[model samples]
Target: MHRLLFALDPEEAHELTLRVLSLWSERGPLLEVPARLLRVEDPRLQVEALGLRFPNPLGLAAGMDKDARALGAWWALGFGFAEVGTLTPRPQEGNPRPRLFRLVEDRALINRMGFNNRGAEEVARRLWRFRERGLAFPVGVNLGKNRDTPLERAAEDYLRALQALEPYGDYFVLNVSSPNTPGLRTLQEGPFLDELLSQLRPATPKPLLLKVAPDLSWEALDQVVELCRKHGLEGLVAVNTTLERPGLQSPWAREAGGLSGRPLKGKALEVLRHLSRVEGLTLVSVGGVEGPEDVWERLKLGARLVQVYTGLVYGGPLFPRRVLKGLLKLMEAEGVRRLEEVWPPIP
Candidate 1:
């Protein structure tokens, strides 16, 4: 069944999956069908982070359900939580076609799909409806500046989207690291990030975090972490995607935009390990998390939570349940009592 999706264009396959999930989300009870089959409801998997309680530490990374179209479906598939959007203040068609590529041999995807969505207002309404179902699932919203918005006013775009979706999300992420938008990654730099955070931090009492790129140098990452603390943000989503192709085997590896999946594991873990040294910053790790061991590695290294995108695309619907179950077995072998006790208390 998953192979059938591989036959279609990457974006087309993604759209079809979302459409099916959206229909499933409409009938709230039907979600229970998949939930019973896929969800692993164990107290040991529960985690506390970003001022919210997650059923498990695993999550669906942002950019999967860009417009909040599949909340129930994600829950049914057994994710602990889900982050939706890379939404802008306005609706956008994004860049031209062939923007998403599958690096089959590399077990990866390269997408330059620039902030495509039906805008913040529409997404917020969808989220409101999702909330009305009262599923107890935590939903995060990732905010991005529109493609046409200049770098100077980038903070305004973020603030506008956050304002629109504030009440609807359990947490909000400032997405300044996507390579698809011209100069978007610049927002991760010292001056730009400091300015952006200053404008955004005070706007809401919700857990506000920043998403960063994997291409940053250690010095640059330090600057990002400093600003995040200075502005009183909650935590960070440790990576967006990589611009570097590394040692890819697929012909499309050279495509522009960001590269995700197996190749990103090394750098993503490197970034998470570096950030883990920081005392108060909560870390949500992503990139190349293909199995239970990857999730366990992040949690052990002080990442309070972890998310997956490319892994899910390749692993099919049962991936979350299988990984979570495997995580339990791994934890039992290591003598872990609970996810909260995975690491010593951060000072």
Candidate 2:
């Protein structure tokens, strides 16, 4: 069923994928997988990050569901948590079509989708309705500025999205990392970032996570860490996606967009390890994480939690659960008990 998706164009594949997820939601949670099979060996998999308890560290990354429309289905499939949206303040057609290219050889993808979604207002409505009834798992909203929004007005874009979805999300992710948006990365610079966060705090009451790119330099990362600490932000997702194409073996690697998958593993870990050195910030590791070993490595590098996206595209629905199960076994083999013990030590 997965390979068949490879044959379709990226947009078609995405639509079909959402349809399948919608169908899954109708059937409800499949609890037959058994809690024991889902347990990691450490037995202490639960941790409070961003004021929320994650059953385990592995979660589904944002962009898979831009609108928070499939939270229930994702939880049923066994992800510990799910992030939705790179949602904007207004609906966007999101760049030209053919923006998403798959690099099957390297199990990677390059997407310049431009933060496409139904905007914060509609998404918030759906999310509020979902929460008013029930939720399958915790959901975080990954907020972004619109493609037409100018650089100076960027804070307003983020502020609008944040205020709209603040009530519905388990957490809020400030996405200043996507390469598709022009000038968005510049927002990561010290002064610009400080202004953005300063303006955001006035309206947002939720735990905030700043999603950064793997392409940052050592100095840039240091600035980010300081800014996050200064603002009392809840955590940092170690990466968004990369613009680099090194180590890729796929035909699609040449496509222009942010690259994500197995090729990104090493750099992502390096960033996580770097962030781990910080005293108070929580790090949510992402990028190139494919299985249990990667999850274990991220935890050891100071990531309180980790998220998977490309792995699911290449490994399918069973992947998250499989990673969690394998992670437990690895933890047992290493004689680690509490999950927090795996956090990266101060350098």
Could you tell me every candidate's TM-score relative to the true structure?
0.99, 0.93
Once fitted onto the true fold, the runs of candidate 2 whose alpha carbons sit more than 4 angstroms away are 29-43, 344-347
RMSD of 2: 2.5
Tens digits of per-residue lDDT for model 2, 235-290: 89889899988877878878888989888888898888787768877788989988
What TM-score does structure 2 among the candidates reach? Answer: 0.93
User: Which pairs clash (backbone N, Cα, C closer than 3 Å) in model 1?
Assistant: none
Q: Lowest lDDT 10-mer window, candidate 1?
A: 338-347
For model 1, the superposed segments whose C-alpha errors exceed 4 Å read: none
Each model's lDDT comes to: 0.92, 0.83
